[model samples]
Target: MKKTILILLLHSSLSWAQMQPFPLQEVKLTAGVFKNAQEVDLKYMLALNPDKLLAPYLIDSDLPLKAERYGNWESSGLDGHIGGHYLSALAMMYASTGNPEMKSRLEYMVSELARCQAKNGNGYVGGIPNGKVFWERIHKGDIDGSTFGLNNTWVPLYNIHKLFAGLRDAYQIAGNQEAKNILIGLGDWFLELIKPLSNEQVQQVLRTEHGGMNEVFADLYIITNESKYLAAAQRLSHQSILKPLLAKEDKLTGLHANTQIPKVIGFEKIAKLTNNADWSGAAQYFWQNVTQTRSVAFGGNSFREHFNPIDDFNKMLVSNQGPETCNSFNMLRLSMALFLDKNDVSYLDFYERTLYNHILSSQHPEKGGFVYFTPIRPNHYRVYSQPETSMWCCVGSGLENHTKYGELIYSHTHNDVFVNLFIPSELNWQEKGIQIIQNTNFPYINTTELVMKLPKNQSFSLNIRYPKWAESAKVTVNGKIQKINKKPSEYISLDRKWRNGDKISIEFGMKTRLEYLPDGSNWAAFVRGPIVLAAKTSTEDLRGLFADDSRMGHETKGKLFPINKAYALVDESGNYLSKLKPIDNLNFTLDSLHLQPFFDLHDARYQMYFQTFTKEEYEKQKDIQKQTEEALMALEARTVDKINCGEQQPEVDHNYIGEQSNSGYDEEQFWRNTRSFISYQLLNKDQRGTYIEISSLDDFKTENLEITINGISIEVFSNNSKTIRLKLPKAEQISLKIRVMSNYTTPRFTEIRIISNE
Candidate 1:
């Protein structure tokens, strides 16, 4: 008996269900695809030395450290971040697995963090480098911030939000009462610190990435039932980002992908709690645009950590850095929030697809390593993060990803249960006195069986999801066929009295199909019942298969195969997906190439999108591809190091600094220049380069340009030549600082490369 309520939501009248999910503790994953992933993740978590993870927090508290800090991002400015992520992972694992060891770990982490907060006295705990000084400046209304920096500090607010989220998870998921107190105190401290800031100043500070600060504040309100926390959440929402989103415009191109997803998640969370339908609609619009236009076939978005233009996938196809793992992690969260509000199976469909392909495939099957990017570039590989050596953001999210599969497998209300994913797991409905066990091999085997254990005869509803990819499906009760016609992407609901020992079986018709890019490109991905399939290319030159502690360790710095060499499907008369011949067990073969589930087709170069062309198209494209590759290869052969301007990590790693300068995306290209000046430190390591090659947009706004290498000015021509090469004066050190300047406006410089003397 459900009643509907109408809400005026963002240019539409909508009605939604009051559906909510069962607690994570109530859902237990016992066996199958998720369990294996969980075990691997647990082993990796235990392998990490907790003392090292806690070092930064201890240091910030003016306390003695137990161990040296972990390297990479951990030892760098963004310390203590992995520690925060670790706490959440432990809490989720404890709740899902009933693992006493995980519970103990959670307790230990919370206690340590609590001690730090107690020492601070004002209830602040963090590992951001010189975080106290930065916040003090902010408290004094002396804020100087940018998209990635605050008062010359690296994302201090973002770093602290990790602590906020961890503490919240510790209390909400693991029931750590002490964690709740610390979290609330910290929240209060934040309120006091920002009480003096004007809304404009707050927005200025929020120019940097602050991961889900608003969402965590709303969660605090939920836990404490305090209106002040909700108000605080509203104050924390960045208006600049939210304003465009609320207006239902797409201003997301060129923005950092993961940085924006969390903010929108906060918007949706606040909307649900306060019934702010406009904000909810904004979040919905963002999700639709990203998943539909920006995202690739694996349900992941972004290239090289930034959103490439929707109309062009050239950057996505050429770069070894593709859709990041952390972006998909947050997208799943956004999807879950929307699904609960409207009870939409489409959201669940996306959740299932991304979970299976991206999140499930993020970790190595045997090594227990985590992947940063799943490159769609043909013949390009991926780098995996080792437990001790890598502390990249993806590693932090990867630790939590596998531990929480039980979260969306099954959800329930007071009288109805919804089995969302066909993973083998169990649900403990303690309130209703029922225990249910689901057993299935899932995508490999199209059948699933559910058995119920009840103390007595019970009346409730069982809603099983019928995925959008299923061609046909059937259900039976205790071996008796229950004839019910249901369409794709709808739920098959059975409402009746059920006694103990009742059994239910479901069988789905699995079929293969082709998914194309949103831009209507010739490239296409193969999908069999929502599982993305890939063909193994060659394993040669799989450099950096496992990441090191270097600044750029997460990237796969191997040679990119020329696009002209890619295998093409020449069949123009029919659909290539249907033409594939089936092999054994979710495996297929097309034109001598064997394809298997992407999650299983790792450890080697693989192709997710096979180039398909008609006879005429193939002939025309082949020569053009070869010509372009030859020119690109010629430039690459003599390059010692290169930087792509306006990209975050590359610029930061190269020590970029500027004033009166701006960067943006235009015509599918990212460029950086300045009204005053902009600069970067280009490495000429091994003394290999005597020339600095700068490529800019053909359009120039200024007649005269000033350029310098290592503080020495060089004469430059003010012409329309897109590529300019300047000879480097003799230098002993391997690094040189290069600056480009204009009195009024500078040309849009795209790439800066240090070329070899040869």
Candidate 2:
């Protein structure tokens, strides 16, 4: 046994990794009120209590919305995602909160799903239409799964992956006995499903998209003590993708970096769980490659939410479109696995960067919408979901996002609670009779105060995370400065007997700097302490393809065309508006284009890194391009908006009555199948400097109507309605506006034109 173990370690660095026995026993947190909120959150989800639509789910056997709204799942590929998420949410909620009801709900779901599978008369059961067929073809290896396909086609394995994952999490996290049984049966079914395919075919299918099935299956195998399950999980591995990562190759350019990384992560966990020394080393190698070599200043990968080529960082810097929030989320998950094995601070460092910059920023402030992509260019806007419509994978992760604030708040070994993420929250450890209250705004403010209350005196080391971003830090014990043994971005140890009412105060100083791309290009990115700095845009100068919904993707001309009114010119020193520090009396939005912490910039146009230039030099460059008809071939910038900094993008003139409900607004009128209607009251209106956009595409969807005063109908979407002519009566207060009624539902207003004869 010793010689065999020695050989395994010799083949890979994973010999250094923790080789724990099968079935990790559950551990209790020493002391804290941390688990309470997770319980409340998980219970709320299990209750199917939706706060957004203000509707409680009818406990009816058939989910009416699932049955009616997305019946048959014939075309839409989103059902499995929703169902998978719902199940995973239940599982995680149960595990984290230890709620019995959650476990019951999960068990119930497994039984219901099993019935559905039985009715299908095969080992196939997909909530969506034709998904079973997709899987069948996937088994045949006819299509590549990872290539972002169009139409009703997608990597079916990826979709089913969520369901399998949810089921597994139900067993592991929530301890649902039924879930385990169902998973074992399902695993058996999967073994038969792939038995007919050749190894090459299986490998090809694995190359496409499939969530962490390989990892989850490996876990299931361990629990069942079955080698077949392990073999199946190994077959699911995409050797092509894993080999490069394991070899420490930077072959990530032009790839769906985020989509692939999670699978590799699953592979990593699978390796660790199965005690594969090579697999574990390979997983770690891939993660380190991404963390040290492939990441941007924000600790994120991918330019357009996919990794560009390894050496082409210069190209990626300019084309940074959508950094996949899902990828970073998975990386953090991967980081935790590594931390558990090695207890290394480096893993936590990456975790901290991603948690603060990506995960925290992924949530929308107005609504708890999770983002799919985070745009790093000044002209691009951060888009978000409106809760129900946007439950992408990020949304699934989003459900888990805020609830586990305690996970990062504390990690325990034999004798310590290693505090990682700093947030304003509380932790109560019932077993230890210890309560810790952490209070502070955090990144917004550098000071975080931890107050620990103990029912009895106890001794333990409080390992506080000295984040990698902090240049220097100080610790104060009960208002007195204490000597910290570790450096910034390292763990500061405090081992002592703690009494009640002991307060620890920490001040971390984070500074900003410029980071250049790997290609030695002149392009650079900004980093303030551990947080990446982005150029904030006040408003978007939406060119074409601008939609009313902020969550919808905007189609712009390209990256070279700047968003008008959103940006300010920076000087040679990279200061806004030629070295203008925001005046104390100036508006908060003046810093609108100022450097923002990366995650605070959801749904706004921001430049995380910039192509710097001075006014004189930039003008000279522009002049050379203008004069040289045969110079650099053609100009890199678009003609419409080469540069429109420090000005508001011209608003598309909008028209509407002050009081629509009091006038002609009808609640009975249906929009988007909803009974909601406009509720504005008519009043005296001004039409100065107000402009309505007129472009060529308006000819087809035009609504030509004669102008009216109080009961007016004006042509809005007409190409012929040049100025959006509207008639406003000279009465005491006659409201004037153009109201759009969509043929489908919900009124679409282009511009609200108001004219007053004052």
Best by TM-score: 1
Index of the highest-lDDT prediction: 1
Q: List the candidate 1 regions with Cα displacement exceeding 4 Å.
A: 1-17, 675-677, 698-723, 729-745
Q: In model 1, which range of ten residues has the least summed lDDT?
A: 7-16
Q: Over the stretch 495-608, how does candidate 1's per-residue lDDT look in tens digits?
A: 889988899999999888888888788888898898999999999898899998987899987788887798787767755666688996589988778999998877899988
What digit string (tens of lDDT, one per residue) describes model 2 on residues 20-69? 21121222222222233344344335434221111111111122343333
